[model samples]
Target chain A: MIEFIPVLLVIFTGFSGIMINRNIVMKLISLDIMNTGMVCFFVLISKMSGSFPPIIHSLDEMNLDFVDPIPQAVIVTAIVIGFSTLSLSIALTAMVIERTKKVKVDDIEKKVGT
Target chain B: MFLVLNFVYLFILFLLVLLRRLENLQIFFFVSFMFFLPFMKNMDEIFEGIGGVHIVFDDTSRLFVLMNVLVFLGVSLKMRGKKKIRFPFVLTFITLNFLYASADLFNIYVLLELLSLETMILISSGGKVKQFWSSVKYMIFGSVGMNIYLLGVGMVYMQNGTFDLTKILRVSNVSLVLIFTGLLVRTGFFLYGMWLPSAHSSAESEISAILSGVIVKGGIFSILRILSFEPFSSITPWITKVSAISSFLAVIFAITSKSFKRMLANHTLSQLGFIMSNVETAPMYAFAHALFKSWLFILADELPSERFDEMGKRLNLFPWIFLILGSFSIIGIPGTIGYAAKSSLFKNTYNFERFFLILASIGTSVSFSKLISRRPKISGWGGIKENLHNLYFSILVIGGGVVLFEFRMKSFIQSFLLFIVGFLLHRMIGKNLKELRNPLERIEVNLFVISTLILGMILWLIS
Candidate 1:
């Protein structure tokens, strides 16, 4: 359980990067990093019960030592969702560039109607 | 079976992305998925959410689901034939529904991240530097909050050995303070959510409608779900007192804000404070507040500020019906939706806490009264078709909420009296429209934050 502390720190660093950074692409990347940190945390939690993956072979009975399969399945879905979000963010970045010719958030705001 | 339904929705989202070229077909598919959600078998499993079935399938959630469907339909109609933000918008909407359906804490975090990404897209579509900067700030604040929330989740998992809310709730008195603190940060409570005003106010009007209306409510819903799992009565009295005080202070700040949109954003925070104070009120109030507030924000967005001078000069007879209807609904006038929510809210809360509710109601009336005072004079009904449609939509939602929902009649009457008194006081102190500051200053910002903190602390101490 204590091993999850580093993952939390990574998530915090990613958050601070997103907050303090002014560049749009960097902020998006920071968001991705934050997401990666969360994935790590969840995966680690799932593995707390044991290191073995929850799979069965025809030649063997149920393996009691295997870790919980539920968190893994949830994480898989989260990863797919995360990828779609990243792609959407990239698309948004492209649109912002097309319309305003800049990637800096501060520069973009100055051009739009105040 | 419930999990299968969630997967189906997820599958439909993928299909939407694939069919991005066929805009109308994609919208139709999205609508079909929403319509079919209720009928899906084993929905109880998915609806039970990470927290449990009581939080998901309860009367409150049913109302929330209904509101989501209606708001989406309205927004989709407004975007009919517009290809530019369609597919991504639908994708975000699916993610929102997934978040709502999710029972687990980690799933909520994932869904919230998706929401933040979607909102950034919508805001930056306007391509303004200020908007982008605001979105950046929003992203930053959101990340910090979610991270803090993760730490709390980690702690809870460490303590209870499970991330599911129902499982954790069964083991009482397990670091309740840590869990509440983490959730407070995520939900935009007091100190942590300062980024909200800048982000919500700076976004395009329609996007602001979603941000103010639905997104913040998602946070509130998550917190409320946790609180509900363990009764408020079981919690320390100090926690309840602190929340109530914070809400009262937030409402005062809301009333003093100058910009139309910023004022509305503050109002969202203020209402959140009130709802938090009344956690024991049937979760239905929270759901109702989300629906009404979203509708109100959408109407506020459509107030036509660009042509304020011209529109003000040309104000006509029929539009007054909408203004009256909307103001009544928002201010909790008898026979309106606000009345229903306020009545239920007041009844469940401690009578000693009446001052906070009264002040919040006054703040709402005063803020809207400012809008009415600035109304453009009507020249004629030239844009009858557009105005009529807007009026129809506004009335439909406000009327539907009051008539269909069960509200205590006596409480409605009392709340109406409070609204009237507040409106009267506002009229007495009303300022010239031209004299009001268009853009708020740094001084005002400092004052707003300082006052909210001081007031929140005072209320907490006194209570």
Candidate 2:
């Protein structure tokens, strides 16, 4: 139950961060936090049946105690994609900063709105 | 065996990417050949039970695939000058093919992600720094939508122990709501659709054509695929009602658009709202929209600036005729495929739905009538000999109009009345046209995603 608290807290904080922040970079960070929260929840759910890493070198070593491999695999892909998305967003933010020297959402909107 | 054709196309696209010196005509022929290959497929040749990668050749997917080919062909023809966009464009085409072919839930997710990535590349390839922001926003919205979708996938996997859509025995209401909400954002439905016009209209016109015509439909297709299991039949009315309301919002927003391309982009969302509510006629309308909307975009590209109601005045004779035809088809003149798609909706629905659909049609007609109202300036422009691509597209649009017409004689009278009503509405509203053109400001990506999620949850609760 406590583990679930962190998940809910992280997700809620992520949402609040996005809502409260006007800076583009800060929003990107909040997006990352939200993504992390989701990944963490998936990993938490996979812990229900077992806790060991989902790996086996020998057929005899395979048992019911082994962790579920699917969510882990899926999370890895999600993390890598999340990393790419974050970096690309940062690069775009840097470009926006270079052009107008403003990273706040309202400032950017004012400059580009016409 | 036809399933392997997508891989083969991908392999060829990969080779072309590496080689980087292939002629454009060869690529066009290759695309044409692959487009025709699906027609050769037997309906029962579905490949399943192979490591969770199932590919089914159903009627709806077939229609979408053909529409994909048609728009792609037009884009290729228009892009004869720019050889660089071919790589990402072909990559997008391959992902779309696989997206349509995919039968499982996870496969759809993966393919959709890949398609978004390819589209991101395509959008940024325009090289304007402004385009970079739009491209990034598209990525942000797309990834968030997919991640939310992944949560629903996880729930379904936990409950059913399988990712294969065909093998899944049941879907809980929570899972249905999650999946539907995620896809709602992806499909650019009403509150979630703020990002669509920016990403779609800001790109180059050819890219805009594909984005409007094909990419957004990926979300609609996935939603349809999920509901095909018939596990949550009770959710149908909710989806239809939401889509209808969204469609009305789309048109109202579209009427406020200031530019031709942006107006078309908003109309794409509005038309999607129509397509979403009418599942049986979705493929037909998707095809109809791909043909006419892309033709309209390609024609709009020939003009310098894309200001609303301006291009109609200066367009040459070749584009003038084609533009009129395209707008007519979109407005559902009795002889075109749009008539078939639109009238079918009105035919099967009940009293309110029929009235709602007719009102939507009137909105469509009024909007498109704005497109064709300007008097054509005849002189000083070159003839049909100079612009062969426009001529070719015109032929295809006309041929498609003829082959796909499904007009009933009675509905033809109804369509006439709708046209007159729409014209009268247009006159009454014409004086306010300047104020009606709404230029939407760019919403922050993270806030947009969060709000969309909350809206989805509200929809889930009510439904």
Candidate 3:
């Protein structure tokens, strides 16, 4: 659906950021954005199947359609995993900076002589 | 009950992380084995895995768990006085646990990424420039492989509407080529894993042990999972042939490699190819190789350079027990663990495939011969404590292999003659063999493309 276009755009932008950016931190941020965009895309697709959250309530006997909960569960797990990945990436980046004291990928490469 | 135990172990790991106590990492691994014990209560649960929930304890997985626990205990004992080892060590352990527990395709991907990230961190921690470049190369290759796999997943999801391998296994041929190719890339088939030697061998010895031992095994696990559950009915012939051809070429390449660690890395690739060729036997062989090879890499890494001369001197003093046991296990010597897997493979594969296995085994023996020939000479001054620890770890691994072989004695015995023949052939050619120039030189663009094409064509023909 057209509603998914923005998510797609975000994902595209993330990919481009990674490709074009020479700074390692910028590239890592792009990876984060790409992961977030993926989670959003999954959520948006799940939303297409229903109009409301999947939570059940005993007080309401009315017909309250609910979206598929599977993708939502998967996305939540993915998000947690993404956070761990982000932390690890930042840790690695810090290590790199500590050693080379440069955040630019090209500069590090030059310093290390390929 | 098994699920609860798994959750409990994970919770314990979480607490260890929160407390920031690194020694608890070994305790956590020990607890994981304790957890696995209850799961083994119902023998039926052994076969039941993550997705398929099948009724068998996958002999291979059991072996891997045992090996992992044993080596980890040995390493942990040697790890005293090392500060700030908690985070990286615990993270790696958690990732390995997750990898072992995962059943679904996407779960494997997530775990693999975690493993890779942890590996990069561990490698770069040494502050070596070469290590950084190798890690960068590893990341690039890994990302490219992951993206290709993601595209395949997209195609699979579109076709089958599910990512659960159990469900995917029920469907056939809809996206077979895509699935296989994706998995091939992920498993480091042929030239695709060119970065493996650099990344795996360049790291510190302990890091190398984990990378070569656990990380690459994760890829092999996924490949085995796909082969086992997926509807390979349509592509069996093609898969079999391609596996045979690729595995043969890998063995040849491994035989030609030098540098102790680099040769071992190539051997990992070649051995993986051999395991993949006999799909029926792959699950167990893959599991056993991961267990044994990981330990071997650790042992090889821990060989003290300072005591190299002492080790060489005392090498003959200690009974040839460890070397004989370890070599026999790897070369499928009779009454060793490798024989059990080899027998199963030979029994299931066709004559042509059997011939390939024979040649591959010979290549392995030849490569390892090169390894043994370069053993560092030991001096008399090496400390008793360090030597004792080394002896204990080496014996433990060798003993584990022996126990595995005994457990599968009948199958192992059947492969005895084949192994002896292979070993003799290796001894003959290995002695006369001249070392090639560093295989790194062949990584040039033109040679890379040519090799890839040649390998691909051979695969096509064999398939």
Q: Candidate 3 chain B — worst ten consecutive residues by lDDT sum?
A: B441-450
Query: Which residue pairs show backbone clashes in model 2?
Result: B256-B436, B256-B437, B256-B438
Off by over 4 Å in 1: A1-114, B1-58, B169-182, B231-243, B280-282, B300-319, B351-353, B374-376, B379-392, B401-413, B432-463
Instruction: TM-score for candidate 2, please give it.
Output: 0.92
**Tens digits of per-residue lDDT for model 1, B1-463:** 4446556865775685666645563355456457556554323443444322222444444445555555565555444455677656667667666666656667676777677777777776666656765665555455545555565565566556666666664433333543455456555665546566667777766677667666676776667666666532355454556566666666666666656677777777777777677666635556556555655555554555633333453344445556656666777776666667777777777764667767767777877676565445544664754453355456655676658566566775677677777778778874533323323222124224433543464455446
Q: Between the candidate structures 1 and 3, which one is better when assessed by DockQ?
A: 1
- Report the C-alpha lDDT of model 2 over B301-410, residue by residue, as the tens digit: 76656886454445555556777888887877777667777777667666655556667778877877675665566655565544666776667767776776665887
Question: What C-alpha lDDT, on a 0 to 100 scale, does residue B463 get in candidate 3?
Answer: 73
CA RMSD per model (angstroms): 6.1, 2.8, 6.2
**C-alpha displacement of B239 in model 3, angstroms?**
4.6
Error of 1 at A95 (Å): 10
Per-model CA lDDT versus the true structure: 0.61, 0.72, 0.60
Which order, best to worst by TM-score? 2, 1, 3
After superposition, candidate 2 runs with Cα above 4 Å error = A57-62, B29-31, B38-41, B49-53, B309-315, B380-386, B436-463
Per-residue alpha-carbon lDDT of candidate 3 for residues A1-114, written as tens digits (9 for 90 to 100): 677689868866765666567777777687678777777766765676577877777758346767756556655866776676566656656666777888776677566542
lDDT value, residue B402 of candidate 2? 76
Task: State model 1's lDDT.
Answer: 0.61
